[model samples]
Target: MKGFRFGSTQGAFYILPGHGGWEATYGNETLGEFSSPQQAADEVARGLTCPHLSEVDTSTLEIPEKLSDWEIVHV
Candidate 1:
């Protein structure tokens, strides 16, 4: 289960199914607990710039390191 990757500073994150909720993690480090996977992903993505977010079953998401210099579209 891979997560979004935005350059080196923005490390990998994941949303895993837990007992009553989902767990958001950065590598082996647990970031927080959420009620749903979408919430987890949104939370993580909120902390970074133009993160290439993906689902748990999806492949690793990659974004150009120079994303900060490019214009990003939000929707």
Candidate 2:
């Protein structure tokens, strides 16, 4: 079965299709199960406290060697 991952410096959380619904996990540990992929991804984002992030200092930001730092990897 193919699924996607949200990776970080710490590790990665995988969102995959499972019995009856979608599953969000960090390695062998289950984060939660949801009825849709968006919910599963939202749960993980909520856990990471993304809403409270401070604004970045774009003045110092430089272009990455990659066109975009983000990617969608199916595993």
Candidate 3:
């Protein structure tokens, strides 16, 4: 699975693969993982408490279209 990075320098946001689907990581630690991008975004929106966060910036990683729906398992 592909990922995206959001937020600012104080603590950037990350969306990656988790056991069930995708995961969100902030700074150097993981916040949570979910089954879809919307789910992951919701988790970050509800959970993040970063002080320097004014807005979340999101950029999609280059991933093959064929593998877009594949589940990413954290190893």
Point out the worst 10-residue segment of candidate 2 by lDDT: 58-67
Instruction: Report the alpha-carbon TM-score of model 2 versus the true structure.
Output: 0.61
Best by the TM-score measure: 2
Q: Which of candidates 1 and 3 reaches a greater lDDT? A: 3
Error of 3 at 62 (Å): 25
Which candidate model has the greater TM-score, 1 or 3? 3
**What lDDT does candidate 2 reach at residue 65?**
23
Could you arrange the candidates by TM-score from highest to lowest? Answer: 2, 3, 1
lDDT of 2 by residue, 1-75 (tens): 566665654456567887899886665767678897677765565453221224322112231222123234565
lDDT of 1 by residue, 17-64 (tens): 666887666556666788876666666555532323333322223423
- Compute each candidate's TM-score over C-alphas: 0.48, 0.61, 0.53
Candidates sorted by lDDT, best first: 2, 3, 1
Q: Each prediction's Cα RMSD?
A: 11.7, 8.4, 7.5
* Backbone clashes in model 1, listed as residue pairs: none
